[model samples]
Target: MSAEKITAEKRTEFGKGAARRIRREHKIPAVVYGHGAEPLHVILPGHATMMALKNHGYNALLELSLDGETHLALTKQVQIDPIKRVIEHVDFVAVVRGEKVTVEVPIIVVGEAKPGTLVVTEASSIQLEAEATHVPEQIEVSVEGAVAGTLITAADLPLPQDVSLLVDPATLIVNVTEQVSAAALEADLEQAEVEAGIEKDAPETEAAADSE
Candidate 1:
């Protein structure tokens, strides 16, 4: 993963009002901290940061040019508005080359399960300890021709060179099960309704007969 060059300005202002003012100017307030160094509060170009993150994923490597010094950092977290989905604040962790960092990589399932079998994913992402500069964007799991009763666990996942799993080897990742038939699905729905004390409406003729 190549680092993106982004320029940042040191920010002395604090509080919500200051943050809102920064956002209004198309900049994002961010803090960089790690390696026993004091947290550096700064402002980053909003558009450039968004574009870099979109191209590089959440664990993006950034070359932050602050003042006259350059700092290597990794994106640790981002706060976004739930309604607008726009980034509000960012947390950056300074890192050095050749260091290992723990991160969660997304799990992607590829191909299809065996006919009449359904593939259910139990884990959406896996925890890994990988080189900070070489963290994988995602991991792929192939389920092609997997039959019912097949189980793929964390230990079974393939890892990139130098990457190690941080999760338990016995943790379940994917499970293959027999697909439920339409009749079976309907029966299950009916059973759930009965358990909930919901009664099916009678036909008009049956209601009239009962009235009589």
Candidate 2:
């Protein structure tokens, strides 16, 4: 992964007022912490940070230049304004080369399942251990021509030589289920109502008893 260079300045103030002032200046408040070191609070350019994040996501490698020193960090979290959608704060975690880290990678389903069958995904992301800089944003699984009852498990996924699955091998990720017809659905709903003691032709039992 290519490193994205972003200039940062140390933050001296704290609280909502300080944060608002920082945002007013078109800067984002961020904290860098990891590797069991003290957290460093800094300010980053809002627009550039946003753009870098859009392309690389949380795993984006940042070349943070602070106080004439550069550090390699990964974006951990970002808080954004609810209405404005502007970034409020960001969290960065420092990392070193060859360090193994756990991250959730998105799952991608490729191709269509068998014509009449529908594919249901039980897990949208998979957990894996990979190099901080080499963490994948997403993984693809091919379901081409997969028919009903076909289950894709974690063990079935193919990963890069450097990546390892952290989840259970028996965990089911995707399953192919047969689609039901409208008539079949209606019949099932009717049966469910019967089991629940409800019927369309039923009268008001309390009213009839009082009249009798």
Candidate 3:
């Protein structure tokens, strides 16, 4: 994916109050660090930054402009408001072209499994080592016509020629299991209620016993 170029303003103030003041001006605070250089604190445009990350997906690379200099940074972390869903803070790491970087790419499942089987995903993402510029947007796993008892592991994932998996090969990723029918679910629920001493129509049964 391509990097989104954003103009960044150097931030001189810190703390919660300063951050609030920055957000009041339609900007958000961010930090760029890594490669042994000092951390650079800056303020970024709120709408632009959010849109860039949203359109480019997670682990997006950014080309930043600060003063008269231009630098490349990769997204490391993002903090967002729980209720408002606005970005609060972002962290980035400086990187150069051709550098092998480790990043977590989201796993996307393609195609439908065989009928009567349900596809269950155990992990949502997988780690990979690849060039900073060519970091994949996502990893795809296919379950087309896969039958029950089918299991897909990390090693079974397909990757670009230059990319490599960083996690354990045997890590479970996705599996195809038999789908539980409605009747089965109702039966299990009834059994659970009985075990918990919650019998159905208990009041009616008590009234009938009293009459007898």
Clashing pairs in 3: none
Better of 2 and 3 by lDDT: 3
lDDT of 3 by residue, 53-162 (tens): 99877898999999989889999999999998899999999999989999999999999999999999999999999898888888999999999999999999999889
RMSD of each: 2.0, 3.4, 2.4
Clashing pairs in 1: none
Model 2's alpha-carbon lDDT is: 0.89
Mark the regions of model 3 whose C-alpha exceeds 4 Å error after superposition.
186-203
Clashes of each: 0, 0, 0
How much is the lDDT of residue 154 in candidate 1? 97
- The TM-score obtained by model 3 is 0.89
Off by over 4 Å in 2: 201-212
Error of 3 at 202 (Å): 5.5
lDDT of 2 by residue, 25-72 (tens): 999999999888899999999999999888886578898999999988
Across residues 142-183, which tens digit of lDDT does each residue of candidate 1 receive? 999999999999999989999999989999999999999999
Per lDDT, what order, best first? 1, 3, 2
